[model samples]
Target: MQIDLLRRKIGLNFNDGFAEVWLWAPNANKVNICIQKTEHRLDMLAKEYGYWYLKTEQIRPFDAYSFELESNTDADNAKLKRADPASIYQHDGIFGDSTAFDLGRFEWTDQNWKPIAVKDYIIYEIHTGTFTPEGDFESVINKLDYLLELGITAIEIMPVSQFSGNRNWGYDGVFPFAVQNTYGGPQQLQKLVNACHNKGLAVILDVVYNHVGPEGNYFNDFGAYFTEKYNTPWGNAINFDDAYCDGVRTFFIENALMWFRDFHIDALRLDAVHAIKDFSPKHILAELKQHVDKLATENNRPYHLMVELDLNDNRYINSQQQGGYGMDAQWIDEFHHTLRVAAGQEKTGYYADFNGIEDLAKAYNDAYVYNGQYSEHRKKKFGVETENPGEQFIVFSQNHDHVGNRMLGERTSTLVSFEMLKVMAGAVLCAPYLPLIFMGEEWAETNPFQFFISHSDEELVEAVRKGRKAEFSAFHIEGEAPDPQDEATFNRSKLDWNKAATGMHKTMLAYYKTLIRLRKENAAFNDLNRKNTQARAITDKNTLFLTRSSEEQIIICLLNFSKNQQNLQLNLPGNMSILLNSATTEFGGPQPTANAIQHNGEISIAPESILIFSN
Candidate 1:
């Protein structure tokens, strides 16, 4: 009998002189456990139903060990295998020997690093593969200085989990416990995080808990890790509340802890959390939050968990004290839609539902368009109103998914006017919610973020392309979706780093730098309290005027969404100084005689632009 002797549930409890190891083997009547270093062999004593435990005086790091199992009928029908699930340094894939890795091996220099508060975050999202031509964790470390120079507090990297092949966006991760060998594995990730911390930049890892990739998935061989009861877009949902769910939940929770404890990542950004179906008393998200919070408290380090959810449910971001799942923040897509529509640059798809200044105002004021109201897009009532502070929401004009999902993968820079781009940037960066900038948005990299994938299976590749086309056909987008499996698609998405030193890219980078600097230095922009931030539309026109005040200063943001410049009357309380202007000729705007105009009570508004005035 070729029994795959994969250890399903293995627990190791250690002390100074001795260690206790427990495992589950339903078909096994007799088990032989061997410790590599001490060469101690033990006949496991049955602790309970189909359970075995061994208490011995052997403890060493990187201790190679295996378990041999035998059935009641025959002694020759036994198999030996590794124990631990997360064997950091795997030699020959999943079936290899389990090597005990000491978490204290790496000497971390980030002793003073504290996680940036979610409310004060300005995130810069990057894909390790396309972020730089080198395409590795070390390459990202080399670029940390650039991110820090741009005033980004956190660097949210796309998933780095081990997948089937080398190059992938990491959403199709299979070995949730293993780091991608292409991206230099677990040690490289640790080095990246340590390097990021050394530069005062917090690291936020994007993790997919919705579904594992089809290939290299061996969870089923171990136990009932997934459920056929609930289904997701990808496939079967994880068994979060089923019979063997405790172990499954522990697997993910341990993975989270591995990233935090072993890799020293400051935060985790849960990807597509709405798809995590769990109909139990304790939802996986809630339980995970509790565990994370406890870990944070014990370590005396600031740990955060952000969620990417489309449910528009305020409960996701609400405080646990309010009978809600405690998440640090959530990505707000309405903010992007409203700003995009208000700027009059509506692309195909979701833009059809949002095309007015009211939407932008609602997005600004309430942080969501649904807010328990009827949504024409979904054709139903959606989203609960958020009573929490606005900073709990993360807003962005563009992201990897938004740009990459397009048929041609055109970015906002390709669709909107140069002036409008600045306006959108200003609106996003100055909003009460935390701002997230896509990889090259600071410099407006011309390269489109085309969707790309490397699937080993040919049939799945065809299905992916067809599925993409079917998705966009409903929205009436021109042309079929590009084949992600095509190498050209991935190649085209690489950022042209040289562009940052030239024309539009240079201008956009400067604009972003100035805006970020002002945001950091200004007390008004730092204010997270919604009561201090008030936004009022300039009449029923497509213009918005927002005032943000704190104890130290008062700032007002003026945005004009029209194509042509229109003279408008303004109401001001006191003298105002032009702190920042997105329409300056320096940022790909038309040359203007006046750059900074001090006004007593009024100001001239520029077309398709944003102006910040402070007192």
Candidate 2:
């Protein structure tokens, strides 16, 4: 099997009283393993297919080691020393040597855990470093019960790959296999996943396979792991279809499987797959899906692969038999952008292409607002219509990218009013697609999730600062951008959990709980068939009507985007009663009397509020 063959082809594999070490260095004349804190060295014999291998009894578990390579060509003659690209544990940070550890020893208690259906997922995205003051895997385990209480079915953690200085957003990670040492290393992460499964929560890990970080990157010295033929915003694209690309593909494929097979991850949210440049006969994503499907079949469990794609193409989520990549789901950023624009957010950058509620209504009808339509932002016709089901799309009002990429990283709570916050929450939960919420969003957190990085290289640090300031030029914000390299910036981004217990924050928490409960208990909300969904926007009244139905029940969500109260009377089919009202005093709005007065198809809706009704 390709899975078993790839697993044993690279890195250090420990057996009975001996260890087998393999490294893929197509351009190296010789390779040697240098033991940490000792003078011991082992020379590896070159085998076929440019693979260096050694079977010796000297290496043991937890043994720190580094690879020393001799150059084969005069173009690059300098001898190189670096950690394993597939290191499982980098205990002493990214710059330190790699450590060998046994993966089969962890006692997993999640053997009986079953996968949750995509239609029933209420995903909660979190950044482990900023989730709590402690900022580690063990700390995250302490909050699994809190998530359960909030009615969250899945927890999607930001990338935890080993990066420099332990303060990155995880996109700057250089090591693919190693878990961040500052996040309690591999064992603690395994414990957290195990604990989440025991508490009936699924875990989705974010992985970046488009490009590697700039700092501590030694791929250039090793082999052809990068290609100059394509460029990404981060830098050169990964060598997916270039020469000697088999190793690069296998390396990342192993990384994805390791998370599922070793760490027991339920899903993987692929970061920025649009940036992955590949022109091979079989795309890398399709190949990955094939491997994951086989693995899932062998284990008798379902493993999901989700992607973050800017392009509104359905080929990523379509089945392989239908000439697609076979992704389970994708992040629908258009829903968030259109919803924000309709809520009176500034129409700058990509938001300029959207025009209020009309675009939002379009997104409700079709998954993409720009399906083969001209976009002012891109100055071109973008996207194609797809017939994918609603459950294949994940929608959110606020996420890490939408909030953190801003000049000051202001969340929706700080950007909009309290009533509008309730409206936004209701808008997401009532949609046919899967819903996701960012950390601290339920209680309306005010802390800024600003961009921050901690790199030791002064040149790279300065470059990041300048690049951040330049990226914000389109938004035209006044004050200077936050210093990404500053330690204070990271400290200010931590969530203040204490705020959730007092004042409006407490009320907002209750409102979110109610919204989540309605989504779960109501058949109209839980059923994800888009065929039964209907949406209409009254532009003059600045109102939107979203009606969803199932065999058991039917519900309608009325949203008022204006800041003025509007009263209307319309003829309808059945007698409707209020299910939930955002304008009630319990949710920090006006008194209960300010709520809708429904009588004979006539009602009054408050400004910037949402009212859900059912028959």
CA RMSD per model (angstroms): 4.9, 1.5
Give all candidates' CA lDDT scores: 0.77, 0.89
Give each model a TM-score.
Answer: 0.88, 0.98
For residue 19, model 2's alpha carbon misses the true position, in angstroms, by: 2.4
The numbered model that scores best in TM-score is 2
TM-score of structure candidate 2:
0.98
Q: Once superposed on the true structure, which residue ranges of model 2 sit more than 4 Å away at CA?
A: 5-8, 74-77, 593-595
- What TM-score does structure 1 among the candidates reach? 0.88
How far in Å is the alpha carbon of 197 misplaced in model 2?
A: 0.3
Report the error of model 2 at residue 45, Å.
2.3
